[model samples]
Target: MASNLPAPEGVEIQEQPTAGAWGEWNPTEDSVRPVRGKHRVAKQRGGLARSSTVLGVGVIAAVGASGIATAQDRPQVTISLPSLPDLMTGGDSGHGGAGDNGRQTDGGSDAEAGTAVRTGVIPRQSDHRADAGEVLRNRILQQAESQQGAAEAQARAEAERTAREAAAQEAKDKVEAARKAAEAAAAEAAAKAEQEAKEAREAAEAKAEQERLAQQSGSYSLPTSAYTLTSHYGDSGSMWSSGHHTGLDFAAPTGTPAKAVAAGKITSAGWSGAYGYRIVLELEDGTEVWYCHLSSMSVTSGSVAPGETIGRVGATGNVTGPHLHLEVRKGGSTIDPLAWLESKGLNV
Candidate 1:
């Protein structure tokens, strides 16, 4: 029989009969021990080839797993294969057996695998960290917006509080100002009333004083109407029986009314020797006043008040014209009537 198995490297092929073995085999360790200057075979070529094939298959499987991993990690990815004609154009015709074995290992016919390869497409992987970053950015922006809204609400609240406080303060200020204004007006009114009262009191006092003076000892008035001082008392002239004037002479028209100088009583009235229509008055101070040369006598023997009309003036009692001879006598001695009247607070 022809052997189909290849020989190991550094060893010759020979037909050898073995008593215990049933087929051709490699040299046993006991029979193939090498001495010096002889090389020992490391591994058979067929075994190396089988190991290489397994490593290639493992690498292809690892690449496919990496592609699957990429598809899982990325979006919008596609997986497709090349066409059979493209694969055949890139491979040697002598590799048909290998391709058939590869097709068998991949669980498909060569045509189907080639067709799948031609149609399959792969896409790039996406970064999952980028999507996570986008989510983080959106969260940050939302947080920022929330914080801004909260801050704005707080600001609005603060503004409202400030406005309320200001309004309250304004009301308080207005009340205070109104109070002060009321106080000022009240004070002004009080002062005006006080001044008016003071003026009224002073006017009343002055009126009372005038009335009192009219009733007191300081009261006096003119004794006659429309009279001129024609002769004074004790004038050195030949108009009297004693050869001198004895009283003051007031000359006037006839029928001029003569009044009492002060409050007195009429002691004597009527005509006398060398004195016509005469009247005499006795005062409270024991003083006497004589009125000679009267046109008429109105008072009888009675008390008289100051400023009362006693008689009228005329040419009587050795007078030159219509005149009055007024005499003041104390203890039957004559005195100047004008001086005596001035001493009694009379403005003659």
Candidate 2:
């Protein structure tokens, strides 16, 4: 015979009875067994509730493991069943499976069952979820910092490149300006040098001309040796046929020597129109000199050398006293003899 006996802790335990010890088993009697009290009903309900709660915890653990496996590169994880704590305890069975305290009839209260589930499973799952959340937050922050650093480095490099270009451009401009200034200075120097050279050449030419004039004054002599200058040419007078005096006068005693003024030919040695004797000498350049009012003529019509005696002074024709009248003619015109001699560099 098989007997369903309630154990000491309200758990049902089945036993095999020896043959013939109990009568033939009746299934209807077992099904229709009468409940003794409310404690027995409450004990049965509590046991079923506790089993269901344990099953629920296993399902939750499996879900947590699946979530963790999908979040990382790892092998698929196995769902392990949670170990359930024992709900029953040994007690005296003389009081029909109840403890000495009446409160123990329902095996254990709802509060104790809930405590076992939480202590074994809920705390471990909460800790795993918190760790996963922290790792994700840290990774996101590191990526943001790295990207910001790269952007700042690129901006600094670009700024340096722009500065270098500006500096190079400024240097080039300065070089160009300096080059132009140098060229301008050189051009000014060349112009100044050229002007100085021109001035020096003009001054040299003037000095040479002065030296040439000094050399020409040493070659001429006067016609008479000693005489007093009584009259000058171009003097206004009525003592002669013309209205003006046409010759220079040298007054001296009779028989004074008269010399040739330069090397020339004697064009005439005697003259009669002035009521006296006269002599005329022709120079090499066709300039003629007249020696009038002469007491005697020494040279005739021939070439005479300079400083040679030509005649003697006397109070002869065209003269009011013993004086020599000297006339100079060139190209049929009479000019100032003193002025003509000075032009030839003679200090007359």
Candidate 3:
């Protein structure tokens, strides 16, 4: 028994009979089958083109994702630093980053950049502090030098003043010594002058006393009676061998009164050889007057007055005749009676 199968829509059905079998067989076609030769090769080429297109799309999508991630990270790349405005204006704003200036850039992390800026600014501040210290040291040294100079000058001035004072005191002492020497010289000169004046006065007084004594010794007066000179003093004749008169002979008559010629005391009233009754009278100045050749004596010794009768004239001894022999003497020397008597304003 063989039977015919019904065919489906848009398909042809075919069957094959089995040998020695009684049934017809219909084989199902495979949905995936190996194409033969050139048809398989053509199908492989189409599959390769589709795979290259898918790979190109995937590479493009990966590049687009990398660009988007880079965009998002742009705002996060921060650099913190000091800004120009902050430095110039001395602002208190604490915020610092690359956003402040678009032109400025940094190669380090945020903290590292900030530390570099701070280190860079420290050198300028330290330099200013060093300069101030140097100025202060110089001022201190200059002030010390000035003070030392002033002290030295003051010491020098004091030394000069002391030297000047010593010189002035020495000069004053010298002047005082000279003044005392001059005063002593003046006193010595005055004393010498006074001594000389006293000597001159003594000499004048001695000369006056000598003149007064000479005047007293030369004065006398003579007795008055009528007489004649017979033998004079110093006359030589044959009456004596020596040819000299020993006494003055006055020729007068006997009994002729003899008078005293000066005021005196009668020192002698007696007789003697070559003179009859001789009488000697001593005057007030110690001079002797003799009346000789007297015949008689009226006044005695120690009694006589001026112009008083002392004796009576006569030739008593060694006489030729009656006459008077008169003599005058001062001290011990015989002198001419006429001349001595005339000097006292009397005439024989």
Q: After superposition on all CA atoms, what RMSD does each candidate show versus the true structure?
A: 20.8, 19.3, 34.9
Question: What's the number of clashes in each of the models?
Answer: 12, 0, 0
What ordering of candidates by TM-score runs from best to worst?
2, 1, 3
Q: Candidate 3 residues 1-348, lDDT tens each?
A: 344443334322222133366442221232112212110000112223212212323333443445432212222112233333323233312333333332322223323434534344321345545776888888888888888888888888888888889888989889988888988888888787777777777777766655543342233334647778888888888865467765577687888788787788998888777566788888887878788878898887775666778888887776788776777788777788777665555545
Candidate 3 TM-score, C-alpha based = 0.36
lDDT of 1 by residue, 1-348 (tens): 234544445323222234455442223343233222211111222333222223323333443555443211222211112223223333322222232343211213333433443234222224444675898999999999999999999999999999999999999999999999999999999999999999999999978766665555355667787878888888887668888888888888999898898888999999987888899988898989998989899996899998899999888766678988899999999999889876665656
Model 2 segments more than 4 A misplaced: 1-218
lDDT per residue, candidate 2, 59-118, as tens digits? 334444565321112221221112212122222222233332442222333334334433
Most accurate candidate by TM-score: 2
Give per-residue lDDT, candidate 1, residue 67: 49
